[model samples]
Target chain A: MVKTQIRFGILGCAKVGRKMCRALELAPNTTLYAIGSRSIETASRFSSENFLPSSVKLYGSYEAVLDDPEVDAVYMPLPASLHLKWAVLAAEKKKHVLLEKPGASNVSELEKILDACESNGVQFMDATMFMHHPRTLKMEEFLDGERFGRLQYVFSSFSYKASPEFLESDIRMKPDLTAQGAVGDLGWYCIRAILWANNYQLPKTVVANRNPSLNKSGVILSCGSSFYWEDGRVANFYCSYLTDITMDITALGSNGSIRLHDFVVPFQENEAQYFQACNSKFINLSTGCEPARSGELVRADLPQEALMVQEFANLVANKADGLKVGKKWADICRKTQVIVDAVYNSIVRGFEPVEIMS
Target chain B: MVKTQIRFGILGCAKVGRKMCRALELAPNTTLYAIGSRSIETASRFSSENFLPSSVKLYGSYEAVLDDPEVDAVYMPLPASLHLKWAVLAAEKKKHVLLEKPGASNVSELEKILDACESNGVQFMDATMFMHHPRTLKMEEFLDGERFGRLQYVFSSFSYKASPEFLESDIRMKPDLTAQGAVGDLGWYCIRAILWANNYQLPKTVVANRNPSLNKSGVILSCGSSFYWEDGRVANFYCSYLTDITMDITALGSNGSIRLHDFVVPFQENEAQYFQACNSKFINLSTGCEPARSGELVRADLPQEALMVQEFANLVANKADGLKVGKKWADICRKTQVIVDAVYNSIVRGFEPVEIMS
Candidate 1:
């Protein structure tokens, strides 16, 4: 019997690529098949500095990784502006695409990438690691349970104080490299968290908050926006590169409420916790109340990134088992990009409400 | 030496009045001097049910409590529509006034009450209990410290599920009884929390969210709004009667973040906790982070309500020490009411942004 573990290749030597390299090594059904950079020396140096296994392949150019017959999937962590080109090439080569988020520069670019993957019969997923966390599933259960009732509101914030060096030299500060700045870097996670809490329902309209601060290059350094659904469900998100690192999600429903202070990245690698309260009420003298909250600790056998890798590999192997490629994730990725573009449009139009056509 | 305890007259038998009655009893410088209702039997029954001392006075009309010479201060917990009438009468009688929140139907009515208090030369303070909590002081210390830096963002949500009976018949559900409905009841806290977080600086504009759900009489049952400062500081709040009870305040500054789950009425009467994070950063493999958070417990010698009564009494007694009547609290209350009115106006104008004119 032949072993058929999914083969993974990562593009670029971005800071995030180091984490994905470790995730591919830890994921049970995946292998670290290749690492690619524009320069062979850079890729080799990254491999050696990280002490990666000797059997892993190294390529000088991204196209070499896509052309490698043994690499079953490409984990594209390239900049947001570069996604459309590399992702389409990877898909045309029959490689499943695991892309980083803000998956594309805009909806049109994201649509082109998605269409290429669909045409080539490959699974496509954004590298949103927290989505694969066991705690997220527990939160979803609470949101979907009878005790929780229907969801009404969601609020999320993600921010970190970027170093002076990062502000000066990071690709994220370059408009041609990362179009949305903090909106792409930190706000993507916040927007994804909000959409996930609402079961990926695209909001009818998006309104940018009036207090966006832009950098010298006119890139967003900090910003916020609100999402409105026709059914009265609403969500808001804030992201910044000018504040201390904070990631939070609060979802309120008719009967229950859930909150996590570190939803994007858990405080601990192996465990995550969320607080929930149900049927809360004020009692005796209004000093105390019923439905005292309790935090549920979810233990992860593998870290969230590893689980994300494992989940993507499972989808790839499922296709090998004669199943149809999963379009649900691609559809979510497209919708998220559409909202991101809508928020940008709204901000550019003096914070006017932008109707989400989709 | 002559004893100088401030005397408190509670001018209603409402459920909240019971809590205030206990607070007055517990406050070191205050005594429960009088109880009043439309019927003498009702006042007497309330005193007996609440186990009031036998020496306490009972009155058949609110004006009777105001007329009592021994009642140095009046705690008016009347319905919103009745606040302007009774509070003015109490102020005309030269009694220091401690009034319940949503102190009047709108900003104009609140301004009238403030004017009356100013003309009478008596202290005025709203009975916003949480403001007096020791936890609030501790949180303020953190916010003011170098570690917290300058305020950048604030988010607050206060909600509670209204029972069917309460929705159908409670004063909070009636337009004449509570003109602002959930906005007056729950949103007052949220708006107050945001204003307090910002050092009571009024926002330049207030924009109500588009999805406010209103009762049949056109009172807001659930709503949200955003406040924008001139220097890019932003605050938003969500208040509701249709969601599970959740009181949350998350204030993020340039250097640190502070979060408290039970900001309004804490889960415990004597102790409250807030979490603060400073200089947070991701460490090792981006899996875990540095500067992990720790909760600070603020233990109170007196319950928040009792502290509120104590603080108000101190201001009243200060008048005897040749101090002018404390106008700080009244000013804060007026600003909060102005923002509340602005939110209501924005909603009334089809969710347009209303410029807040001080």
Candidate 2:
């Protein structure tokens, strides 16, 4: 029997925020208690349709939801640039916070949000949806061991230019607001993959750089990042928003290399291809192979969001500390900022290999 | 209509020289006249029995065949370490010379051989049978005219491992002898590809680097070369013996990218693939697809060996100069030497990008 359910009040009744509302509706020991948006009509529609009786509350503004003593936490799906401000504000209201990906503009912004949670005794974490996907743990398993052999190199490239419909001069386009586009949108995904393989340890002296020309914004929309792990395994990542959307990662090891296609969105069949190097001969580990099926998740499965929500519940219910989760979020945010900043700086200064300031 | 056929004398009867015998056996106006090996029995057995020449001459000493006035030209496939030594001797004897892949051990040595050929007034050219292929002109057609779009990048890689039969003590294992194993073997092939595409124009600057720990000798066995063509196209190449054999070149233009599969052997059955950027999407240009048939030499049918041999015949038969041929040979040889040398230097100096000294 479930007791002591944690309720979430979603801020910003945007598309992602609405999706989170549906996820909360299905989650065990959770309920969508309230809705908040700048527009009262949007919040009212969500609250009335999803919640029953006094369980439903509508707010004309985000601050109204945070101020409500009845709400335990608030989910922040505002623009990436506004994440830090809202997260800190929610923490100040003693409400646990689930901030979306690119968690805060950079490392320092993430730290400030985390600090607010600490002082106010509230939980704070990034709602990186990929993290909630269980198969991601399978990828973690693949890279965790020496089964693939001593890692030599890593290659990842994620790309997709925003459709004209999506490129509506949003917060993402603001250079100072979003720290550029591709780095936050696609590049962060690659960095997370690297960190996952590196045991959450940052690379030693990364040769990360980027050159995003052609994108109108002064920010780099194309970037190449290189990571040199302590173990001498080098990882290189290529990301571009001026291209199509696809995720691929290749890990070259001493004995064989592993190529995980659709890594960002692995086969619903969960296919993984292994390439074995037989003393200079590359033998395909999977030839004419069918992709293994990925685990099926409900539309509201919302694993990454669910995990962030669950972690907050554990912190409050079990009195568990969220130091590790907050720190990892900070680390990812920090490296991404350093890399993207270096790339733009390098390109501006003639595309030299700019050493990451981090 | 038939005239006196050009007679070929082979020294060392090595693998390449043996392959030369087989290719000459297929040649239209060519005859294997004589064979010379360190051992007379070896030469005689190969010349009389294996090759089955109408009249065969065998010589135990290299100079004996070089002095053969009947032998119009010599295909010298000696060990890489011995190429310069025998090439000079053959040139001094007034025999038209066909040196294998790397005409000289080093850039300085190549210059010295060039000097010898000029002073002796004897025809000399490197036996890069690939250039003889008829398909090269087709590729030239694309790169020459503003064919598709501005050429921005070129990526080429060629790799293959040693057969299990390779002995550790073989000359391929000797550092000083086969100083540039992968670089000279595979790297030279790619360099030729770029030069051929650029119509013999030198790149403004060549930035080269390679893996340090992978090679046994200090010389580069795996190399990466970046070239800035005089017209502003950037070409990059990768070479390795430690990877699978991939003789593919991807030329990315503003509007599209052309993929040449088996570039060293371009006349394959199918067109590899072409990617064109359209409407903010890359569409694979499989618009024109057809089956292959024998006796059909499309753009890919560049009778590489035939051209080199014919050029040699033209230069020798007319009592004319091979200066143009020599110049091209010298360019490839010198550039290969420059890149191989620079890449090794880069690795030794901590994987730094080394500038080409050519």
Candidate 3:
């Protein structure tokens, strides 16, 4: 029997990568065939520690994994700082791609990846796993439906609130390392969700404000931005290392609203939540969890192994659209980075309103 | 036997003021002796409507209430826009005062009020009515124990999300009429709680950012403010008329954390909550309102009637120094106004960090 299931290749031993490996191994018909990293020892160690069925192959360099005929797609879990370089390379190698989100550091870099993937026949998906989640889809439906009434306001925050020294030169903290700092890292999801719900249209004006410590490498510690969309939707996006709150989204409309109490992490425990708008009241229907995927399997719980892996397997095996999936990932990356960069620039120029670039 | 209960007079029949009259009637020893407003007809109607006995004098002008010999203290349930004006006037008449929250429009206004109260040897207290409630005291005791370790971060939001026509000159939308917009109205409690918890110390710095909108009086709209205190505790305060959420204060510390869920509204019908703490191992403890207050009250149930009236009764009957109560209230009120003004100044200047002054 010619097995039609797409074989997955793990690239890099990042925390996200290690977690994705577990999911690839679980999905039916999916095969975790190989592991690759810069060092042979690291790749070999990950395969042994994480992958079951020791038959999983280990390769010294990422190129060797791409060369392998057994693996059909690559899961680039490298830092967002390096997503463009590897994603473009994987497409040139004729391998499909599922690059972790904040898909690239900037527009120019993401454009290179998008052009490369289009030139090649293989699929390239920016793994926004969130876009695939059922809850967000339901939220989008309500936002589009008359139930939410005319959309008036949106409030979202996805801040890690890490210290200055947590990762000194980490891409999330340094502008030089990543085109944007906290705004893109934590703020990307917020910006993208707003853009996605409002359609592909752009905002007419963007005013941003930032607070950066002079003691560091001009990395923004806290940033707040207000974007006035072309559709007349005015939004305020806040991301900070200064305030900590749950990751969620609430779309407030004229008559009523819908809130994903855990919009950021949908599969908290294989918890399937659906919304039913009957008459005036909207109800949140949740299926809690099963004994099989309960406890640590919950996204809010430690060891968020299943959710990340399932998204990886779907992208690799499903042949998801590079333009639909990959372009959006890069697009969000750019929009978030542009706004993030604009905010810091506004702060530098004394809180001047900065227009976000395309 | 001398029956000395605090004889109370209320000025203004504002929405919140009518609520205060009810609270005054509930206190054990207090008498709602007189009521005054701008119109004698309105005052008479209020006196009759509230079912006040005919002996409870009705006055044509607020000044008549201030001068009435039977009136021991004045409770001003006027708009935050007029707190300072009435508070000062009441003090000048030697009437002890209970000024409403966001205590004044600016520091200078509150300063003048304090100065007058001091010179006239009168008592004054800002109506942070929540603090006098048992829950606030209970929560503070838990936070102060330091078992949760040093307070790290605080996330608080107070919003109205009311319609555009909420009021023709609603202070929420118009910054000039309200001085600083929602930050003065809603964000006051969040700021007051932080200042109260941290003691009467200055924050090292504060940064603010607000949404763009034309207030009725051309006031600013939504805003975000971050404050860093001398002790390294950080707090983020968000306020808006475009969106409203239940107020929550999550004080995360070094060891564990204590969350005062639903921090603002004192009334929760079936809404019972308690503290539950845990480390890496076993569960610590959990306690909440096994006994619930009737959730029907619209924060209209503040013990202001009992506490403020009792304090006044004590001063008149026991000859206690009005100095301590007056000074603390004055200090809290002045600081809150100063913070509100600083936020507005920062927003006008594009959310620049400013030093809070009182």
User: Which model is ahead, 2 or 3, in terms of DockQ?
Assistant: 3
Candidate 1 per-residue C-alpha lDDT over B1-358 given as tens digits, one digit per residue, 9 for 90 to 100: 2236999899999889999888988899999999989999999999999999999999999989988899999998888999999999999999989999997999899999999999988889998989999999999988988899989999999988888898888888888888877777788999999999999999999998889998788878899999999999998899889998889999999999999899999889878888899988888878877887668888999999999999898888887566766589999999988988899888889989999876
Clashes of each: 0, 19, 6
Reference-based lDDT, each prediction: 0.90, 0.58, 0.60
Error of model 2, residue B27, in angstroms: 6.0
Candidate 1 local Cα displacement, residue A186, angstroms: 1.5
Better of 1 and 3 by TM-score: 1
Tens-place lDDT per residue, model 2, A1-358, is: 2235777888886556655665566466566777788988987776666453466688898889988888887788777778878888998888877776676676667678878877887665566555555556655555555544455555565544455555547566667777656666677777776666555566654543422444466655555555554445555565655443335454444433344334554323223222222233322211111121112232323434455466556655543333333444545555555554544455566545554443
10 residues in a row with least lDDT, candidate 2 chain A: A285-294
Q: Which candidate leads the pack in DockQ?
A: 1
Which candidate has the top score in TM-score? 1
TM-score of predicted chain B, candidate 3:
0.84
Cα lDDT tens digits, model 3, A1-358, are: 2234668887887656655665566555457788888999998777677644778888899889888877778888777677777888888888877777665776567778877877886666665556665556556776777655666555555543354455464556656555566665667777776676565456666665433333267666555566665444555555555433334444455443444323444423344342222122211110010111011111222222344445545554444333233445445545555555555566668656666554
Q: For candidate 3, what is the DockQ-based docking class?
A: incorrect
A-chain TM-score in candidate 1?
0.98
